[model samples]
Target: GKTHLASALGYKACQEGIETRFWRVSDLVLELEKAWKENQLERFKKKFNRVQLIILDEMGYVPFNKNGSELLFQLISDWYETKSIIITSNLEFSSWNKVFIDPRLTSALVDRLIHHAHILTFTGESYRLKNALSKIE
Candidate 1:
């Protein structure tokens, strides 16, 4: 289901000796912005580079400013084919332009991400809500 599967995948990858980082899209953007403001941008990218897989959870849930969009595009460009990134987005491929803001950037990102990526789409009732309903019954 559409839970924190990205985070779980990251943890599993890390356990298999592949460095991984799990971060929500909003939190990741905020942290990256902070690093930029604090003169730690390079350090932040380095940290990101060390990870074999970076799982970004809840993409498209939060809107991004220009800086955030640029920062995210930079990350995607830097990791293109060199490292794997897993993005869990509520939006479909057609709607990715909304999150990315720029059409060119969105195309580049989709191309790179889909080049060697496996997409798993889940559509159903959320497990949490189903469980809660069962409990009430």
Candidate 2:
């Protein structure tokens, strides 16, 4: 459901000719790790300099390794204040350290994300689950 909402926003931004990228947290960190190994991390990050928005989906679904966590923090920090980001995460902020490993990094990441953000909390049965059960019934 969160992914669906973010996708709709991304679609609208694209319709308005805004440059946008949609990346799953796991996939993005893996790509960053690859870029780091290839010694092209800067080049890879630079590609986002012109993009207006980035939508990071399913952030807490996979925990990040040290390299992945650090790389993801760097990637997000790069766009802090300059570009727009929409992150969809099921984990509460208090539980984010479980995914990030480093408490300090997790704190910093949450701080960056929450500042100037319009917080939206979804509370209910998942739409997908509700629909599936209704169909079966």
Tell me the tens digit of each residue's lDDT in model 1 across 34-133: 9999999998888865678877889899878878888988888888778888888879988988887888878887887888888899989878889999
- For candidate 1, report its TM-score: 0.85
lDDT of 2 at 85: 98
Per-residue C-alpha lDDT of model 2 across residues 30-116, encoded as one tens digit per residue:
999999999999999989989999999998999989889999998888898999999999988899999999999999999999997
After the best TM-score superposition of candidate 2, give how far the Cα of residue 74 lies from its true spot, in angstroms.
0.8
The CA lDDT at 7 in model 2 is 99
* TM accuracy, model 2: 0.94
Q: In model 1, which regions exceed 4 Å deviation?
A: 131-137
Best by TM-score: 2
Q: What does the lDDT read for residue 54 in candidate 1?
A: 77
Q: Deviation in angstroms for 20 in model 2?
A: 0.7
